[model samples]
Target: MRLPRSLVGWFYVSPLMLVLIPFFVLPMVVIITASVLEGDGFGGIMPFFTTQNYIDVFGSGLTFNLYFSTIKFTILTWVFSLIIGFWVAYFLVFHVKNQLLAIGLFLVCTVPFWTSNIIRMISWIPLLGKEGLVNMILQGLGIIDKPLEFLLFSDFAVVVAYVHQLTIFMIVPIFNSMARIDKRVVEAALDAGASRFDIMRYIIVPLSKSGMALGSIFVVSIVMGDFFVVRVMSGGGSASVVAALYEDISVLQYPPAAANAVVLVLVVMLMIGLILRTVDIRREIAR
Candidate 1:
């Protein structure tokens, strides 16, 4: 029997709504409520309400700086990851001759996901530390006499750490975009006397804009709110917004933690809203 329009619409949307209600809607409501009130992450919570926590987050200049630093990391990580990732994906999509070889190269990017994020991040310490592999290798090669003290615990290292983790997030979306391009278009461009750059600029590049956008969205959001990477790499979470919340919670400052969580949610939503406005995710990922 043919379902009514309302019924069909309900059938199409109920699953998503069901998932959202629990995972998305409920969590936000509880969190925001917790922000306005007082409660730890466990049982026996306080139910008192106050706006001081929200005010405190805004009033603190240090907190604002931390927020800016996080945003800076997010922006740099996204931009660089996209640039490098797009190039790699483009090379694979249009350059690799053997399809299997191309697929294998793409799979190499995802190997990080198989391991724990904590383990992977800690692994970086040995390579970038003052007495570590990079400095030793450089010294061995007569590159420099002094070990770079700023190598491990600086913004540079933090950004590098983020990019290492985030490049795959950028690459996968771009690769998906490249995969959908009609191969005949590339051949047609070549047949029409197009140069190598012309084929990329005129055909392959234009088609992958959606992928770039998708990758930017994924990379930006993940890097912006990441705690562990910034905490470990930036040295003791000194200026990390996420780590600020971790500190608050560990110290039993539940209200401020909730407030930070609220702010983080809003920031993420703002990012997502910006992305959705730029790219119709439905059409981009439909294939």
Candidate 2:
């Protein structure tokens, strides 16, 4: 017996739905439910429904501060990652003549991923620490009189760690998008008296928007959701929304933490929705 068209589609998506429902959707539902419930003072959840968790989340100045810090990191990381990732992808796509060479170069970018993220993050410390390689070299060259204390445990370090880890995410999607561009179209534009800058401004940038949007979404979401980088790199000086949530969780404040998580999820979804509305990623990928 033949199934209906909708049923056929549902069958095709059944595996994905099975995975998402159990892993993603169920966790989110639980979190949302917990957000409205009261927490017993000793790490237990009470059955009583209350809005106090959300009220505490919104009414607290700490929430706004945490969000401000998180957003600041997100914006800085996104801008730097985009600028670096776009140019790297552009060079690989437009400048590299040999396909094998381009592929090899791309593989080199993934070398860092072979290691643990924590290890990679910690590795920056020896180089950026006040009494470390960077400071030693600068001191040898007389670039500064004393060690630069701001390098390791500051906002700068946090952003540096985020951009280092996340730039690869930007590069992958942007490279994929740029690789799909027609070389002949670029040549045609050049033949029509369009300069390099003109081609990049009109053809390259416009065509790469889908990839940029995708990369932006990745960078934004990761930076916002992350707490470890902020907490460790910033030396407990800077705190993100997730970091604050981590604190709440550590203190057995599950209900408040759940409320914060729900709010964060909504904000991230809103940002992603805006990106999807601006550029249909699925449609672009299909093309």
Candidate 3:
């Protein structure tokens, strides 16, 4: 009377499948369907199938420009966040002798996240604006004669906002991986005449690859999909692929927008797949 093992596994996962099917899979199916349909000049869709939407998306020069801008910001944010997050996690794991204090310090990092992301992003404006605190402080210090125009509503601001928001995603995974390292391994390496840099290069970085890969996935996905921060922070001077998609949807260009969405989803999945190929996350987590 016993059921098959595979059937039992499926039974256990049925609830999750039900949720994903209705919420995730169904929506994706609808989008893919819409992407292949024809759109009227107005805010309507024709009952016809065509590949023109994909063609338009791929043929447009604006598409390349938008992707280029987005990728530039993505790389800048990823590099800076990785550097800062790695050092912060390393400091907490290796230097902090008191576990309670390290935990307290870690909790401090999460305090800014208690507020909404919009609020956190907007908070940078007052400090970075032309007449804001930074400029005022510079003037008072006699360091500059005029207000810095590029601090806010520029590419600098976009990268700063992105790094501030996304660094925590990097920290959590890296911290978890570094925390699991045995202190004895480090001590033995030191006893064997290994330099600090050697220990870091050989032991720490290799073991932390899983964490870095996980964090990179988070940073890359979020940065690529975001539009609001780029639009607002760049003062309409820059746009990302998602921003163009938003504009298309606003103008009732559903088919083209859906096509862009499908392309973006594919690109993101490819990036994540590359990261996964670099590290076996499931096995690392199992350890």
Summarize candidate 1's per-residue lDDT along 1-287 as a digit string, tens digits. Answer: 88899999999999999999999889888878878886554533588888877888889998789889989998889888988998899889878979999999889878887888778777888999999999999999999999988889888889888888788887888999898999998888888899989987888777888888888888877877788888778886446777888888787777678788999888888888887887788887885
lDDT of 3 at 23: 100
Per-prediction tally of clashes: 0, 0, 0
lDDT of 2 at 1: 89
Q: Write one digit per residue (lDDT tens) for candidate 2, span 1-287.
A: 88899999999999999999999999999999999999997789999999999999899998999888899999999999999999999999989999999999998997887778888888899999988999999999999999999999999999999999999989999999999999999999999999999999999999999999999999999998999999999999999999888888999999999999999999999888988888989999888
Clashing pairs in 1: none
lDDT of each: 0.84, 0.93, 0.94
Cα deviation of 240 in candidate 3 (Å)? Answer: 0.7
Candidate 3 lDDT by residue in tens digits, 98-200: 9999989887886887779998999999999998999999999999999999999999999999999999988999999999999999999999999999999
Off by over 4 Å in 2: none
* Per-prediction TM-score: 0.88, 0.97, 0.97
